[model samples]
Target chain A: MSDIKILQFAPFESFVSPTFWHKLAELKLDYDRLSDTKRSIFGYYTNRKASGCLLEVDYSAYNSEAQVPKFSHVAHGNIYNKNTIEEFKALDKTALLADEGKQLLDDMRSGRALSDASLLTRFFVLSFADLKCHSYYYWFAFPCPLTPALELLSPATKLKEIPNNGNYVEAISVLPAHAQNFFILHVNEQEKVCEALSLTAALSDFDEERAQHYIYCFADPSEYENPAWLMRNYVALLLQKCPTLIGKSLKFLGLRYDQQMHLDNSLIWEVRQAEACNYEHVQFVGWEANRNGKMGPRMANMRDSMDPAKLAENSV
Target chain B: MHIPNESKFRETGVLTPEEFVAAGDHLVHHCPTWQWAAGDESKTKTYLPKDKQFLITRNVACYRRCKQMEYVGEETLVEEESGDGGWVETHQLNDDGTSQLDDKICELTLDESKDEMFTIENGKRSPLRVVTTDDDNEDDDEAIDMDTFEESGMLELVDPAVATTTRKQDIETNPSNLASVVNASETTNSADSVLRTRTYDLHITYDKYYQTPRLWVVGYDEQRKPLTVEQMYEDVSQDHAKKTVTMESHPHLPGPNMASVHPCRHADIMKKIIQTVEEGGGQLGVHLYLIIFLKFVQTVIPTIEYDFTQNFNMS
Candidate 1:
């Protein structure tokens, strides 16, 4: 950086990128706008080194190589997206008696990678499940204490149906800035954009200039007590500040200086028990082109049989 | 992949010094390229090239047109404003005297090495000579201590053998070579105090349909932000200042390319000069062409404290 007296060209103008603007809009929505919103988190990525910001879910905690009785619902188990990790763990033992379930159980116990059907079935269930509905608990025999049973029953809502074999049941692999690690968030482009926009809209009040300045900084709501709810605000602030972030889009969204987990927004979920969630390291597992000229099955990271000639050469 | 070479001047023989001067005067009176510095110095704020320096005006890309907002980091700001008083600082070194190893990485890092190499090749042709100071007697005395810290006095160029041979050939072929003109000035200066006129190198060439005048700069003063068209036209004639000439940014040359412009009528004047030289079956090499251009430019910019000569090889 010697006095750069000599330049090839004279600078003409300075401009901002569209991604920065989108981030600004999102940050404003997250800071002073949206709360308890349906579209809470937009984009997510895993940081192996605990570069804390906001944690949506720590799948790694639940499923790691070091954990006993390795947990891999997506790669080995019968649990779908609709089934929470808690519900998946709590599945009835009787369900495993069926032939397909038995085969899945055998595969899981044998440490064999589950077929694509198992993973897709789970995703299909989660994708189709009506997450927006609320189930009310009745106090009396099938009814509220003060209301008639028939009156308590409300009009049935219509549920959209889709062929599981249709074009919808597709898994997308997300590669973050860290090349070694990736996340398999179950959603498509439309869902991601909608969630990103909603997050940005939450911080719409903040001016663009200020939004550009503090978009990467975590949102601090000291009064909120619940970690889950607090976690949502963190995600909201993060998503708004960095709308383009699939992972590491905000280059400066690094770990905070303070190690206090109570105030830190980076940690999404606390991994309290090892036995509760079984985790396994995936070598390679995703949809690949099959023999039938269609995307089929989950393939785990398995290396080919080593060649004798190559082994001999390595030994030399 | 390539266009065929065709230059009318190459077909004609080189122009003599007398014919070059006559052609230069024709363009100055009829088709001037410079304009007078408008109003006071503060109002214009254009860099008035002192002795031994010249303004090189050219159109460059506008930074204001960028739509994307960029956060210029501290590192970037420091690099941008490192030069003295914001006149982007660059040094003119004698040939083959750079810390080449230090810049090797920057050169290999990007594909911009072609232009970088070209600038180096260009630097080989005209190694910058010693720089002269315009400071008053008192300022010079005070600058003695400062001189030790700074690069003091004129840095002489190590002249190459090839340049001497070329100069001899130019003198032998053309009767009105710049060396003779410089000698004439030298003789006149000996009679009185040294004629300390600043020398500038002019470049007149066709760019597409237009001819442009690009002056070679040696250095600039403090606070010289002469990148814009308005800030560069202070030394031009008043009438010619209104003429629209785009200031282009040179990709490689740093301080030397400042306050320069690509005037529209440059090609027209150049064509006229070529025609004048070609009439006598005379050729036009770079040296003779420069001699002619300065002859006309001197009258147009009479008030400016500068002179034009081909004492050193210009890129």
Candidate 2:
């Protein structure tokens, strides 16, 4: 037991494009004046050609129906716009994370996550846009359940090292865009073939006799050695939906692709998750550390860029 | 802002929206790194196809500042020493002092160094010298007085408070000491050694008014933090940094204005390049428009290492 290593996951780096702030400003003045409500927003992550685990939000993030870019998966989230700086600073971060986490666990147990795997990648943003000054203060949180810690049974292996990986890659490529993010891969060792199945289909066809053939796969956005934080919730979702897999060693595939859509960098790990005696009370963690790595908010001073008067002054 | 009556890409070098799409598809086919993005659905242009609204390439690394490049020529070396604002400007003038399209090609052959600079090998060119001539009058609006010039120069100095804050943030964010390791190696002056650099997300959107493609840049610092407009200026060629690059709202996205290369002179430059090609007995196709556009935009941002696959020849 001492020889086994605990699995670690890289945190998501929030990339807020300038357009997001501009849109927020527009909303504050025109639509959401003095109303500090949670607005539905969505961010995206791409498994292809990423240097780090990133959650990117642009102007289109405000549009729920915006088309997801090629080779990217959408993570639906909400933005809590605070009216004042003091209100933003005074907000209870712990309770906020807990609320979001409880929502995620509920979704998992209710089969909502199974229907839409994107729910497993839930996130939220807390912000205060100083429209008058053109400065915005914000923080991001990628809520993840902390129960049922997964441990690596052995060192991770590259997908290329596994036999018949080409078949697995080929099958995964044909999956619909929605299923591409999270799915199950079944490898028939005797026949030397592989098949990709949607989570809903795989859950319906779960067989304990052939459980050994099932391999959980996810589109990993992290370029680091460790998997991305999204895997923690994914693991929780799997345990909540299928309790029989608890305490059983399973093969997990971190499906990463390059600019050319090649799976040369994909990694495979043998992981085991211990059962949580108290499943009702699952703890949640994951508030993104500020630029200082502390539990705080970061500020962006856009006065020079966003302020029309300042821009006019600079043009001279 | 004059719209061409007909598609005169091979003659006048002005491109219609259809021609822009054709050229963009050609660029994406050759250079897989460049992709067509639809941008905001609400902001889609009626002229462009829905999916092919604009071209974008992200995380293009700019390894070093333009000042760091080794200037080989005596004239450019003198220009470098004059001041930070003193960027080399080359004008290909005829023997009679007139700037003509035919004479520009002749002048390219006369100057061996200039010929070597424009030589495209494996889609890469040598560090560019800023080329501006009397014909580029559209940038006249960017001309600034001495007071504004001096104020911008002073703004380049690093503030002590900001420096300390950045250092503190670096220490706090990087718990594994990975950033320190990268910082240590970056201080070395060796050309081959790893250097902490800035990266840019380059976007090319077709301008209907000018009937040409305009370039926009969003840059990030070494820490991947969004760079301020002043910080982005460091990566741009000094000559064009003030004159050509202007902060404006993106056509397809509602952003607090991004730095864009004005498209006023794009048609004129394209026309000149087309004439030069025709005079050399080679016809310039509309499909190759973006390749040439990317090649010439290097003068505005010479350090950005964006990939533009050059399988074809340009004489």
Candidate 3:
């Protein structure tokens, strides 16, 4: 009982560049005037040289077609821009996250996540851009379903310690951009051959007898001792796709890299997932903590930087 | 000056847009912490490639105010000799054979000091730069008198080390018993001694007019709240804050104005460093321009702990 370790995932720390707010303000004033609709946005997290789980959004995040930087995986998200601060404050935060969680579960159950595993790591932002004062109030939520908590069957192992991990890392690197985020590494220890497969193909080729050979891998942005928050949903998707694997010990690879994109900090975990009483009533928990590490929205006062009158006053 | 036709960086002390890109690429390649951000697409400069608009490094910690670290160096001699007026010249590199450049900067500082006084008289909330001049040795007595008067006028002029020590003691004593117990354990552990210090997000963008890479800073306080322009000056070296640092909008990002280190003197300084490196029989490549730029920018904001690998030899 003392050996059992419940896997604690590191939550993401949202890093919104000033350019992100500026673009949001522009969208509010020009295009999104009085329209508090959910806008499609995307953020990228790098697996290379990260100190923690960091999800960064900049001006390019608004561009759906924006190229993800090398060694980075894109997480598709939506920005719900509120017209007024009052509206933003009055919005039910729990319901918002639950909606996103439901979408994730639906995607996983409908075989969408198996085909495109990126959907498993969805995030959203609720924001109110105060153009008058150039202040922006915002909160980010990386929707993750909380159910059937995974326990470690054994202690986390470094990727380098695993045999022929170099081959797995090499194969994973050459995968397509979309497939690179979440994939399966099929390793045959006797043959000493490892191959990377997409989640869809991996699911089809899933053999119960060779379960130990299948290493579910995700490009991890976390440099901490624990895996990142994205792994929670990744495991949930795996369970949804293959329900027969419930209560079975599985190998997961949190593929991390250094600045040189060398697989130095990658961690492998042997996890056992418990069966949830009801998968239909899944609970979601993922609202990002503010700077104070509290559950609240943060305000960025851009008056000195954005307001022309204030800029003129300061220059004088 | 050895002028190479292929590269004007060594000759002009200024970098062409291509040279700026090359230098930036070099910086990002070695110091992966510094990344090339595309910035706002609408505000992209035609000179720079869309994706390589600027170089940015965020969350660079500033553990203490500049005043706290001021007395630690040989500048204490300058502090003892020059009084209040000498504060402007204390941070100048003594070994750098750039007295002519120093004199020009001093003249500019003197002129700006007068402007600072006028702004204060007008009751305008201008960022303060304490300036007193010690050009004449005979006026040393008067300068010392002025220093005492200025110290009274500026509340922060009190000895910062003493102030910080007392503040730390207050923090240690004020917490509840349970909190103190936890803090005591944390102190013994040593690994959890993370201080809530001020941090700065630094950005380097190419200035078209000056033909030098301009450095911009956005600071946050211990609580991670954005630091006001006046609060930011506390971290910047008092000598350069007034003359070199200005509140300006970032060229790449449309946001509130950021504190930018004006590039007017950057080319002159870079040229001097290039000459020094050349005199030592080493050719200065444009790729190493940003490394040298960051080294000198350290003089301006000495407390911000941004990484510029210290392995390279300048001389």
Candidate 4:
């Protein structure tokens, strides 16, 4: 059986500071969090509904051919300034799709293809991170790719997400009309697990300077309370809350509670003060970066996890 | 010297271990060394002094001084020779306007925090920068870079946006021109989903010149599962492409809510999902069985439209 226990954020707070990084590798965990929200896991899917060109046909291969714009290849601005990326919004998709959807669009204008932007817009492209975020978002989608199969299923155009697609239909974008929206509950450790082990290395790159400006941009009243401290704390709290972050568990964050309300043991584990200097580098950080996909092997980078039995070892 | 609490004294730019020792020694050599005498209890430091008895505190840096300094609760008057050669006594007041006896140096002044002077650590460097990376640096996980002149060769640029911890400049500076350096930063606006599009298709044209239809596995997900692919064609909603079916008693399938997956066009779709996998990016499968199956289905099915969506509730 895989380790149901996930890594949490609470105990490892000290690792962010240089003083405790050396001790991080020594941490380990055997069980998961107690709540449904906090199980730790690393999941990957073959995204099919993504709307852009696959990397195979990207600019790398087509040097002399027509330079068509792709959604994934389209440039945009960041949240800080719209002054940048101002022009990308108005790109005409007609030119790029001329080769693929040209006949279809012309037919639509000539009563051939439907005028509905949704119909002409078939491919849905998004990155893995975006896909993960979209998992919780709502969208409108049609039932069938075939108008007849769809009409047979529903006379009028019905837009909604449905789940007949098996797990292997991985890595492709579905029609927007068929996109599903639901929240995967994560609490405790699951809420805080890095989508990949690479995230831990990214966490090290986060300094108070960048935290103040970009990543954890302040100014929102809800985030006024020690933005740095709050984010770190919530990350820990949420890690303890979600379970999907852990491998997969029904009870979130592996809660081990006593009858009197005191937790007999914690569900999440964190490696603070990694004894091995490897925790800060890209190799250690990029443990999964270049992999086509997959967390790869845990033993490659996973040094330690917290154990609920060692609650007494806390500094308090 | 007796540092005031009004401002945090940030000793900065601490160098090597040797420098730290030298700095401590310098402070001891320059300042007036006071013995720990049993004077007025509160005003004096009490301790066993050796032959070369130092100051009132073991910490060389944290101490008070004055020329024949008297521990008066009011303030310490430092007597020093002015440039004009007259003896001038200066009183250093505490934050609350109350003056206290601190330290007196032979030739010194306040605001002495030099960049090179302080040895306090900055928040950036870890006080314990243990070897986080192995010295071997035998980067095995990174891809084995393919040589140039390989089929249709061009360097694949890794987008910084994929970086989990992107800096503000990365997200802002040239977001619109992220991958398409050809596109200028000034050529875009909001509501654009192109940059927002996450999929990248590697379309290889199938021509008679090709002895065999070549297929290449590009990327996968975190699980190393193959990414979904399809026979690129018209959208599902077209008239000729539309396959109508009768509004028969329908077997309701799940939605994104239950399985919470890509709703449609997914390889998981009931009719073509198997063909999608069987083909597996190979033209053989798409051409051999999938295309045949699709063509057959289109020819036979007389499609109909019905609304069974409201027939059930979400789980």
Candidate 1 residue-wise lDDT, B247-289, digit = tens? 3433222211233344444445666766666676775554355
Give the whole-model CA lDDT for all candidates, comma-separated.
0.24, 0.72, 0.71, 0.18
What is candidate 2's CAPRI-style docking category based on DockQ?
incorrect
lDDT of 3 by residue, A124-182 (tens): 99988878866677789998877666878788899888766678778887887557789
Docking class of 4: incorrect
For model 3, residues B1-315, the per-residue Cα lDDT tens digits are: 222225567787998888888999999999877888787677778777888989988778776556434533476546635643343343344224545644644444334435544356325553232232122242234233222211111122221111011122224423322111111001111111112356888999988888889999987644344665655765788777767888887887776668999999999999998898899999888888899899888889977889877467877
* Proportion of true contacts reproduced by candidate 2: 0.15
Instruction: Output the number of the TM-score-best candidate.
Output: 2
TM-score of predicted model 2? 0.74
**Alpha carbon lDDT of residue A250, candidate 2?**
84
Angstrom error at residue B200, model 2 = 1.3
Error of 4 at B301 (Å): 17
lDDT of 4 by residue, A1-316 (tens): 2422222111101001110111111111111111112111111111122111111111111111112121111111000101112221222222322222233324333422222211222221111111111111001110111110000111211011212212101211221212211011111232332121112222334333222111111000010111111112222221222212222111111122122322222122121211211111111011111112221111111111122222122111
Docking class of 3: incorrect
DockQ metric for all predictions:
0.01, 0.11, 0.09, 0.01
